[model samples]
Target: MGSLFLTACGNLNSSSTSSTTTTTQSSSSGYQTTGQSSDSEYQSVIQNGSYLTSKARGVGITQNSENMLNLKAFESGLTTLSKTEFSPKDYIFREGQLLSKSTVQKWLSRKSSSNPTGLNPKDNGETDADKRNPIYVQQIEEQDYMKEENGKLVLAGITIGIGMNRKDYYQKEEYGATYTTTISKAKMIAEGKKAAAEVLKRVRKLKGASDIPIMICMFEQAPNDSLVGGTFYAYNVSKSSTLGTWKSTNLQSSVLPTTSESTAINDNDESSFTSFKNKIQNFFPNLAGVTATTKYKNKSLQELHVKITTQFYSETEIRSFTQYVAQAAKTYLPSGIPIDITIKGSDGDIQAFIARESDSSSYYTHVFDD
Candidate 1:
């Protein structure tokens, strides 16, 4: 069986569970391994994490479809970045929960009633209504990868994360390495079984995927914060497990600062702006346009924010062009002021990254892809 390895930042250690696992067990390695149902693991071949569009965003749990949006982008010098797609469809979507964080936390603590079988395979009506839906959306981090077919986005592979309490899995001390927390093997099994059921339920709806392989994975998510990481146990038709990994959440939970101090404006960066524009054009000949704005004053440089809009035909172009322009902006524009870069694509697709001049580690990501 061919397996797809997703490059995530953390480590995952575990075994496999059949599509019908009902019980969970713990290995000597301190990882939770779920029981497998008597089913085949060669059911699907999950592809690498890729891009999608709005219409096909949650196909994993909704329509069992793959992603189809592919973009071609590059710098002026034709330099390309790593092969990754950064668009609206690349991330996961959680149902809007207006309830306070405290209330959501309480809901997650309740035991998961894992009656995996139901009429609506995507979501077991009883469990989804009683245990899963009210607590949180069950699909993992985001739809990982997919491609275009017949002018629509289909899901090639995805990571369906079962919501779990972080405090139950690992303990992070104030001044030491994180330690694995002891969680009941039964609960862990229930989580994986539910995820596998969701995959099987959705897969049944596909048109011609009976023989085509799809990779089904399970992950653990934090209750209300952005902390998401865990090993994905891969289950094949033979009921065997292959270890997989997920990206560690680099996002901080505390609210990002929105307000900036308004100080004197320096309208004197004209020459600097010219240099900036020249450098950007030299690298990205296909650059659509660049917009520079100043707000919230610092001592030397006005809070400098730049938005670079481009029209790229592929993901490679967008990735490299965005990075090239961002690096160029800092060199030409006045330093010591916080900088924000927003990249707008031809189809009005947008993504943004920010960095505080004083601290490099304080980088923040604000997704405006909507």
Candidate 2:
């Protein structure tokens, strides 16, 4: 990730040669009159810095070196074999006459050596993968189709280059003001709608299922603000049957002051996490019954190293806990077989442990198995 630093520029003053002059007169009331200046020097300096930062974040050269190399190889490979007399005029490599198969192979080999990971070695092999040779084969096909059907290559090399560069620019400034103020605001309105449509499509897959509703949250920072703390938007996702669409609901808003202390910052994070968890639980009652435990004790003394054993139970009572424990363990057990939930016969003997997962899908999978 690239870092954004606040830049300062020297303040510029008006030249004495300018016809504009300022005369100040102070009265007993301490009132003074001043001439109107072309611009405030300090204000101008700040504005200039802001403009430069925005532009730099907008068009900064931050190419994905790997992707560019791959693109170059694709273009070069097309240029090499495109020289044959029998080759199609609309083909990607029409700059020269076609070369022999061996010559083409040598060219490809050289290019591949330069970027071993860019082009799959198997692409040139005599297998199903070989059929997909020619690095930019898709581009070539698209170009040919465009010329044959539309009468021209609607998208040129320059256009492709610009698109690639724009992607690089976005990646570099993903957390910068250029993205939030200039790009994301517009993109969120447009792409967020598109994303909502796609979400609706997926929700349709679960039409009548009694599963819990899905929620989405978004956070955006203010312009001229660094992403230090508490600057984001949150939303909840829900399907609207009456409107036949999906919608997001705002949850909360918070802002961290520039002089906020470290303890305050930590408290804010914990509060946000807890609030989010509570909101989910409120919306999904089933989740409330699902208690998560983080420590467990092993019944067998031989496994003293694993002294702690954990288990999960649906019922609130300690006795009924084992039944829920068995259910949780069943998910990971082999098919056509069952495992004993009771580590020991004593009441509340079953201990439950919880583990965090990287994604929402398996958020609770590790607790029972591991």
lDDT of 2 by residue, 294-333 (tens): 1111211110000112332433333343334334333332
The 10 consecutive residues of candidate 2 with the worst lDDT sum are: 157-166
lDDT of 1 at 152: 25
TM-score of each: 0.26, 0.19
Error of 2 at 31 (Å): 79
Candidate 1 has its poorest 10 consecutive residues by lDDT at 72-81
lDDT of 2: 0.24
lDDT winner? 1
Off by over 4 Å in 1: 1-267, 296-300, 352-354, 361-370
